[model samples]
Structure formats: structure tokens, C-alpha cells
Target: MSRPHSVVSQVPSGVLVVDKAPDMTSHDVVAIARRALGTKKIGHCGTLDPMATGLLMLVVERATKIQDLLMSEDKEYEGTLTLGVTTSTQDRQGEPLEEKEVRSFAPEEIDAAFGVFKGEFEQIPPMVSAIKKDGVPLYKLARKGQEVARDPRPVHVTKYEIRDIALPEVTFSVDCSKGFYVRTYAHDIGQHLGCGAHLSALRRVRSGKFTLERAVTIDMLKTAPREDLYKAMISLAEISLMRGA
Candidate 1:
């Protein structure tokens, strides 16, 4: 008789939130988690571009069942954008395509530009993105210098607070729905102000009910003993309790 999958499984089910460091792909964190947790059934809630850092939630074992559901909720982030350049990827990781003189855009002017995107709108996904086209990732096409038409996706930004406005670099926090691209938000704001722009830095701070306060650092994930890692897990029961509340 064939054995059932869970009968042979050894790991518990829960969510593992990691404070992902900059320059690490979300999948790279997953690989480290898989090894640290000793299970191949782990999956992250969403992808965080390699250049961006912060909370990345991983679903383990049976928790993977709710991955898509968890991924569909709103998220919060803090990011910095430089107003003098536009990049191919809409972020710092891509090639710089254009540069402009960043004249002193007054705080009121900057606020007005950001105000244009305060609510729901259409956003064209950048070419250097993981979104697929005919079974190929757009980033692969972007690597070959190929461009393709992408439909505008509807996204909503519930809250955007400017934390600092230091001329060319603006730092801010935003609460936006799933699939909202902060890089694109910056680029469009630049376009509005006629200065061009690109995302210089980004850090995810929250996703739905989960926050970075409950996250483990990437270093701990890399070197912690398996038992220690298990203790860090947010049990499936806890997750249920969170969702119910």
C-alpha cells in the first residue's frame, strides 16, 4: 500500500516571515528556508524584487493551501525615489535610460504630483518584471532588449504619507492593494512633475495582518538550528486566529 503524504511528512504547518535583506530574491530566501526547515513544501506569499528588502512571508507544508488567498491582501511599504532619472525597470536595478535636471520641485508641487495617484488607477507593468508573456517571463524579454505591450492593471493606494522630501530623493510610506507597484508609482509621479524618476529603495513593512515585528532576520534563517527555526514559526492555528479576528 502507498503511504499518504502527510503521514510521511515531518515538518509542521505555519507561516514563516523573514526580514529579507536587500539584493536577495524572494526565491533565494525560500531556498534558504527550505534548507533551514528541511522541507520542499515551502512557498512565499509573493515576490520581492532583489533590490527591495523587508518582510517576506513563507508558507510551509499545509499552509501552502492558503498561499494565493494570503497573497491577495493589501500590503504596506516605505520607499525612496530619486527624481532625476528614469530606468528601464522603473527601479534602480535596471539600466538608466534617461536623466533630467531635477529642478527644485517645491513641497506643494511634489504633493500635487503624488496626489494624482492617491486612489484607484491603471498602472502598466514594467518590462523588467516577472509577469509572463506567452509562457516567457517579461524580464527575459527585457534582457534581450525586447519590449511588449502590457495592459494596465488596476491598483488602489489607500494611504500614502510623505515622510521626507529632500529635493531629489523623497521617502514615503504607502498602503496599497495587491499587485500595486511602488516603482511605477514613483515613475508616474516623476512624469507628472516633468523630472522623471526611479525607485531608489523599497522596504515592505506589512502584508494584511502580518507585520515585520513577527519576522525573523535573513541571517537567523541562514544559520539557525532547525529546532530554533521551528520555534519561530507562526503555527497554522495562530494564523487562523489572526484571520478570524
Candidate 2:
């Protein structure tokens, strides 16, 4: 069999940080970015559910070499939690599968529960995730009307705060290790509250050293030339080499 090509052989290496717009899959953004950069060596650090938006890391050219390392970096998200409902997708993107009475809790109660999520814990990933089981994405199997037992995986929530608490809606922020699923966390928290809930919205604000403030929108990318786009891309290696202050 012929050997697979490496990203190193495709083009010069660099990383593109994009502010992925809502409703567009990470792959869709990569496709447009590939065209914008005029090269095929592009790859993304991690997968973001289409309904979620914000910073998305893209590796271009030989820099795709660092994709694995970058994907391991911790992530930060500002997500909104909508109580009183649950969904198959675990987010607003999915159909409502169940509803429960909204329970009013004091800010201290909400904060305490959120505190329970902080630190290392085992978490079951959402069935809607892109994780592959036997070479098939879990979501694909879910769409086929199949359910499978999945083992809980360890993930760390370094910081989880209830920025705002409301009976029917809660806004919060979290910083978690790679492989952590905010969607699953939201659902689990709702369950604990005795009032089922799901993620209403999610926006990743940071990944490693890359922040959402620098993300380029699709429209902005559409009008920018490959040359300009190339200039904006940052390399993961550079980010990794930086010393923490």
C-alpha cells in the first residue's frame, strides 16, 4: 500500500486561529480556510460542535506537525445553561427530549454545585461527539438509532464558575483539560439539580495561548487574500515555547 502523505510535505508551516461562526462545522471552516490559504496542508486542533462558536485553532502547512500537541492543550469556554429541558444533542442544536420544572436556587447553591465539578473527575462524553468507536463516529451511530455502552473518561475542570445564576437560565465559564465535554457537564449538573437541563449556548473563548479576540470571521476571511491570511496564522510551536509569566 502506498504510504499516506504528511502535512510536512504540503506547504510552509503555521497556525490559523479562526472565530468559527455559528452553524458551520469545524470541517466546513477548514475547507474555506484551505481555499483562503491556497494549500491543502491545513488541519484543526480539535472538533467544535457546529452550534458552538468562538476560537478554533487551525494548523497549516508543516505546522500541522504539532496538531497532536495543540489538541492536548486546555480550553476555556463561556457557556450558557438553559434549565427545564434536555436534548438528545445536549445543546440547543438538538431536539428537546425531556423537560422538567425549573428550580430556583440561591447563588451560593449554584456556586457550590459548580465547585463540585472543579478538579479531576470522570465524565461520560456526549453521544453526539465526533469520537470514533470501531471507526465510526458516535453521532453517526446515534443517528442510526443505536446506543452503546461508553466508559467514563477522566477530565479536569480547572475552573468552573457560575457567572450568573437564573432559575431557567444560567451563564457560566469554565477552563478544562482536553477531552472535557461542557455539554455533558451541563446535562449532568441539571440532573443533579433535580431539574434536567442542557446547554443552550457555548463559545470557546480561549485555547492555550490563542484567544477569541484574534479569531477571524468567515466573512472577513472571504474578502482577505491568501497572502493576508497567511500572515495572520500563528504556529503552535511558538505558542508552546512561550514561558508562563
Candidate 3:
């Protein structure tokens, strides 16, 4: 049975850069897009945590062909982490597993902590992540309180800068290869600082060459007319230009 407003033939196929709102899964955005655009052929290049916000690339219709290529692109993010507190999910959304006193650290000290992780390295993804184990997602096992060994995967960070430094909270920006978990980076950096920590907040600002400059909002997706959405979409020709073809 075709869903309501089924007009797959009416809309031109391309990419939509969404300025995703917090507290919603990536799938939630796609579901809304499917209804708003009145088409089922939609997918996201990357998945964002429910607590995350910012640029989320939605491949619509024929644009789904380049989803894998887009997914493999390096990513950029701005995030904050709280020191002296570690959570089960390595983020504020998770259970507070432990907490300790957060003492002051010199800027050099913090820089030294982030310095070691700037280049190529291996990172063990958080158990709450989307990684697979035995053909089942690791998050599913984490729900059952199961802990399993996971081999670390190689990752590369092109750049990172400390934006703010205050006791218990730090803001920073990072550009890294695909599959790099910013939460894990925070956790490991906490270990380097002799204080455990968890990601307090996160926002993706860029993916590959795409930025959040013209991204549409959730409200726009839900309330705007389909014609308006098509106006904001990146045409296939534009994508080809970005690819230097």
C-alpha cells in the first residue's frame, strides 16, 4: 500500500543538508523527510547520537548512489567534555558510573593530553556505539550489561584545537577520518589527564566538503511546503562539481 502523499515522481532527487536538532536520532529525521517529501527513497550518510545536533547529510532518491562515498569522507565536529566524571556511554546521556574531584590543569597540560591523539592512531569504539560484534550491534549487548573485547580500529585526525578550558568542562573542535568516535577521544584524553571524563555535548559542523551553511531545520522539514525543500536541496550537478567531475 502506498503511503499518503505518495508523489515520488514529482520531486527532483538530490541531497539535503539538515541542521539536525538535538534529542532525536538520525532515523527520526529521515522518517520526517520521507513524509514531508512524500518519498521513501531516502538515507543518511552518517548516524548521529540522539544527544547530538548539527549537519546531517540526507541522500534523497538517486543521490543514494553516492551514500557510501559520502559516508567515507572525513568529519569535523565541535564538542564539550566534562572532566572527573565518567559515564557508561561516555556521554552525558548515559548513566553516571563514577565521579571525582576536578582539579585545575595548565593549558600546556591540556594541550599535551590532546597532542598525542592528533595523528594516526587506533581507537576502541564505545560499547554504546553502532559497531557490530557476532553480527549483532554492540549497543544491543551493552543494554544487557554484557562487556566484550573489541579490536581497535585505525583512525586519523587531521586537526584539533582547544576552544575553551575550565575546570570540569572543556570545549574543542576536531577534524578526523571516518569512524572516529569523538566520545572515545574524550574518554581517552581524560585518561591521559589522569581524570576520567565523558562527552558533555557534540555538534557536527562539516562532513567532507559540505558545511551547514544552507541546512534546513526540523521545523522546516515538517512544516515547509515540498517545493521549498526542493529549493534547498543540492542538485546532482552541484554534487558533481564538488567531486571535480
Candidate 4:
């Protein structure tokens, strides 16, 4: 399927908040935006794992210039942490590294573990991440059964609340600084609890001032007319207002 050449050039330059569907990479969503919005200048501010779904910010044309600034904003996510199992990728997307029987723990014990990670602390970035070493992404090395030394970096868990707990599964919400990885957080929490754990599911609810409420789904863009799609884009001026909000 191809977009009209004339329409492509005429498409507005701005940000479009997308409620990204699970199993689609951030780049995949960008490709869809290109076709639906008739613009090849589309880019996303953040990378969401294929297993993740939620608000993904796409910048078009001139809006791409502020991509770095948008990426610097804090992020909020709600996800499930599954205990008693660990994965190479720290999420459900990877092979199982280890598994253990989950022992019953008091609610306060779980709360105390959460408190240990709150505020400012250092965390080792996971091997499954896009962080690069010698210009090659770490995930590439990970896929080849290679492991390398990585230094711990600082991350702040401003808000880490347990929304619910159902034995091996714990639903939680977190608001954290830029560059924080929720996958690593889940993995570390399990280590603290003496039971292996990994991120089972994730959904980004907020990125800076952009909320899931204002996000349009891929289906919406696919089914809507070009004119209606253009109306859904957030202007550069509005993004500037997000700084104040």
C-alpha cells in the first residue's frame, strides 16, 4: 500500500501520540505512521519493546528536531512482575535463565524491598537493552551468548507502588527518570526477594505531558481519512507548552 505523493509533501510536521499495540516494534509503528499519515519524516521519541504496549510519541518532519528533548522527560508505566522465574532478557521475550519455587512473603517484606529501590540508586543496565558498547548494541552481543562487564548507572525510582499482588504475580506502577528500564527493575526486585523475577507485561501510561488518553491507535489512523489523521497531530507549539505542564 502506498500513500499519495502529493499528500505526503502536504502532511503537517508535528507530534502524534500513538497507543502502540503489543508485538509491534517502535520502528514498526513508525512505518505504519508513514503510510497512514502520508509522511516519511516520522520518528519516535522512545523505543518500546515488542512485548510492550502503550503511549509511543511519534514526531513528524520539523517535530523530529525536538525528539531528544521529548526523550528527556520522565516516564510512567504499569506492569506485572512475575516472581520465581528469571529470563536472559529480564522480560518474557527471552529464554528462561533460572526458576525457583516462590516462598510466601509478608506484604511488609515486599513493601520493604520496594523501599530499598526508591529514591536515588545505581542499577546495572540489562544486556538485552539498546545501550551500545564499541558502537554495537548490547542486545546483539546478548543474542550471541556473550556477556560483558557493564558499569552500574544511576536511576531514580520516584514512585514505585504495588498496585496488586497475586502470588507469583505483582502488578505495580512506577514513575522514573529518563533512561530507566522497567525490565531491569523487575529483575532486581526478584533478586532482593531471593526469588527470580522478570517483567511479565508492560504498558507505558505517560511520557512527560503526553498521556495514553490522548493517544490514537494504529487502527484509528488506518481507518481514518488523511484529513482526519492530520487533525490528530499535536503541533510543535503544543509540545512547547508541555514543558510548562
RMSD to the hidden true structure, all candidates: 4.8, 5.7, 2.7, 2.0
lDDT of 2 by residue, 221-245 (tens): 6667555666676654566564242
Write down the lDDT that model 2 would get: 0.82
Ranking by lDDT: 3, 1, 4, 2
As a TM-score, model 4 comes out at 0.95
Q: Number of clashing pairs, model 2?
A: 1
Q: What TM-score does candidate 3 get on C-alpha atoms? A: 0.96
CA lDDT of every candidate: 0.91, 0.82, 0.92, 0.89
The local lDDT score (0 to 100) that residue 146 gets in candidate 4 is 90
- Index of the highest-lDDT prediction: 3
How do all models score by TM-score?
A: 0.95, 0.91, 0.96, 0.95
How many pairs of residues collide in model 3? 0
Taking the candidates one at a time, how many backbone clashes does each contain? 0, 1, 0, 0
Using TM-score as the yardstick, the better of models 3 and 4 is 3
Model 3 scores a C-alpha lDDT of 0.92
Better of 1 and 3 by lDDT: 3
Higher TM-score: candidate 1 or 2?
1
Give residue 157's error in model 1 in angstroms: 0.2
Task: Write model 3 residue lDDT over 89-113, tens digit each, in one string.
Answer: 9999999988878788998999899
